[model samples]
Each structure stands twice: as structure tokens, then as C-alpha cells.
Target: MPDPMKVIETHWNSTPVPIDAIIRDIGLPLSYEPMADNISGYIERTDGSYRIVVNSLHPETRQRFTAAHELGHYIYHRDLLGDGVGDNRAYRTEGTNRPNANIRPIHERQANSFAANVLMPRHRLTDVTDESTAALAVRFNVSQQAMAIRLGRAG
Candidate 1:
């Protein structure tokens, strides 16, 4: 099995790891668009470009995770084969909410794991335990929920 921290670190240093840069790197146009209720974000493959459409409806934390999750799809899941051969699985668009949806069991888990690691890489999260979720949320420009999730996973 691969070390999750190592995988996140590798991606962080080598590519456009910053959020905006990652958005551009994936050929998505940077824009501030309002998202409807219950909609966190959406990913579209259009004109040979992958666009991540974020719904500014919820708190910032939700948007951050949504972006990272979409990026997870872009990075890890898109290239895998779908024949149940090797480690591949079918793609589902029901969203990555494990409690609500019944998408491909493994892929959703992988994407969530990827999102958690990418959004709050482990090294940076080491000292985060000293801070409250709100403090860490402010520091990361994400939500309290996201901060809690990251903290839980990192620890």
C-alpha cells in the first residue's frame, strides 16, 4: 500500500498545488459564480478542458472540499480503467457524500481520502492540533467542518 502522506507531498511540490493554480492547470476558467442550495460544486469536461463550477452557497469550507474532491476525480479516478481489472472502478456522479449516496464504494472512499490529503497536506497539519477548528479553518481558508475532518484524518 502507498503512504498517503507521501502521495500528497509528491503532488504538492511538483505541480500547481495551490488551489487557484490547480484550477487553471486543469484548464478551468477562474470565475466567481454563485452556486444554488445543496449544491457545493460541479465538474464539467468541456472543449477539452475540465471546469470546476463551485457553488458559493455554502460556507467556504464546503467549497474548498468540493474543489479538492473534484480535483481528486480529475487526478486519480479519471485515468483508471473500468473493467474491474487491476484496481479500476466505474465512475458515479451521485457526489462523494458517503452517508447519502451509494456510488462505487471504493472510488468514493479514495476520492474523499485524496481530497482530505490534498487540501490539508500532513506536514502542515502536524501543528494544527493546538488550534481550534475555527482557527484552523481560518488559517486554511476553509470551513470548520473541513478543518475538523482534516484534523481527524491527520491525527
Candidate 2:
């Protein structure tokens, strides 16, 4: 199996802020335009560049998560898997899917985990005041569910 940590380390080293730096470092301005009917996000890697197409129709938080998730695919899994990586084809469960289901397919799960970790690294989220998921979410700019998962994984 490929080392997921190495993938994350590579992305971390290549980026200064990891999330936003990936855009500016490659000279791509962040555009939050609604993609046509089909496109979710796109990265033009020909010149080692990126252009993410987000659906402004969605909630701001949803779009932010999508952008971060797409960024995870770009940083960690794109070259390894080749083209068309920005397509969010992998399954995401609402409530019934087992928690592990969120992290089964190796690449997709890793990308999700990478996005979560990059956006909310341990060093940044170490405040750990009282263990409330909602509190942590406010601290990290992530969803309450994401904070809960990270806290669970940390233990």
C-alpha cells in the first residue's frame, strides 16, 4: 500500500499554507464561479497549474469543503492517479453509511483525510478546550462532524 503520510508530507512541504498556498504558488487565482451543469472542479496541470470550479449555488461552507477536498485530490492523488481526479465520483454517505465507509477507498479516503488534516492540523487545533465538537469546529473553520471525527481519530 502507498504511504498516505508521505503523500501528505509531500503536499505540506510543497505548500506554505498548504490550503491557500497551493493556489497562489501555482499562479492560479481562486474563482468561485458556479460550474456549468457538470463540472465540479478542474485543475490544469499542463504548466503545473490549478483552476478549481466551485458551485456557488451551494452554501459557502459546502463550497469551501469542496474546494478543500478538491485541493486534497490535487495535492495528494492527482499525479498518482492521473487525469480527471477532480471529479467527486467517490461515495459519501449521509447518516446510514458506516463511519468507515467515509474512509474505505484508499485514494478517496486519504484525500479527505488530507484535506481535514491540512485545514486543521494538530498543531493548530491543539487548544482542545473541553472536547466539544462545536467548539472545535469554530476553532478550526471546519464542520462539527469533521471536528468530531478528528477528535475521535486522535484518541
Candidate 3:
């Protein structure tokens, strides 16, 4: 399988990462569904194809991040998903302030990293003039926290 970041870069080939277009190009259908506040999104394979459904109640940024996260799973861990996957299963996004448990599964961590890399590609950050992480987050259309994590990892 290809590296998730490389796949995203090849598919998007632009700044701000046109995620919707990438999804369309990849033939992964997306839909919005109302879910619990803690739930972010999920992916499922049916008839040899995949579909992603994100929680509509979340903010747009969260929704976008969730979509990217699910895409990460679709790209990286498709084989692990037996039939369907969701927040109730092994795939789930962080909910709220939970104390450092140091128990986050590896797949979740990978998906988060994949999402961050896709949304805030390191090449784009290198060319950024503004030093503010907030500004970069806005430019990348991701949460400030996500940007901060990506900056830390990239630097």
C-alpha cells in the first residue's frame, strides 16, 4: 500500500487540500449524518466500495477533520475493518477533555497523523510567511490544535 501522505499529495496536488474533490476522484462516497457529540465520523465498505459518514452536528472544521480521519482509515486500514466501522468500533475520534491515558490505539494515532499530514502538508508550511499557527490553521482549514500538533511534528 502507498503512504497515506503521498497518496493525499498525489490526489490533491494543491494547497488547502481539496478533500471533497479527492473523495470524488477516489470514488468514495460521503454523507452527513447526525451523531452523538463525541462521535466524529466513520467509514464502511459495501459491495467492494467504501463510504464515509460524518457527524453533521459538529462544527465544519471538526466535520472536515473527521472526514479526513475516516479517509485515513480507508486508505491505511481498509483490511482491518471486517465489514463496517464507526466510533463505536475500533475507529473513533477523541471526544472531549480526557486525562492522558496513554492508551490510544496505534491505528487511531496513525489515522490522526494521516489526517494532519493531508490537511497541513509540510511543503505548504515551508512556504508560509505568517509565523502564527492560528493563521496556518485557518489557511489549512483545520483546527488550531491540529495545526499546532502538525507544526510540532513537522518542525
For model 3, give the RMSD to the true fold: 5.4
Cα-based lDDT for every prediction = 0.56, 0.54, 0.70
Better TM-score candidate (1, 2): 1
Ten residues in sequence with the least summed lDDT for candidate 1: 81-90
Off by over 4 Å in 2: 1-18, 35-48, 89-104, 127-131, 153-155
**Candidate 3 vs. true structure, TM-score:** 0.79
Give candidate 3 misplaced runs (Cα > 4 Å): 1-7, 10-13, 88-104, 127-130, 153-155
Distance from true position, residue 131, model 3, in Å? 1.9
Tens-place lDDT digits, model 1, residues 31-100: 5457446455555555654556666666666666666766665566555422111111112444322222
Off by over 4 Å in 1: 1-17, 30-32, 79-92, 95-103, 153-155
* Model 2 weakest 10-residue run by lDDT: 93-102
By TM-score, the better pick of 2 and 3 is 3
lDDT of 2: 0.54
Order the numbered candidates by TM-score, best leading: 3, 1, 2
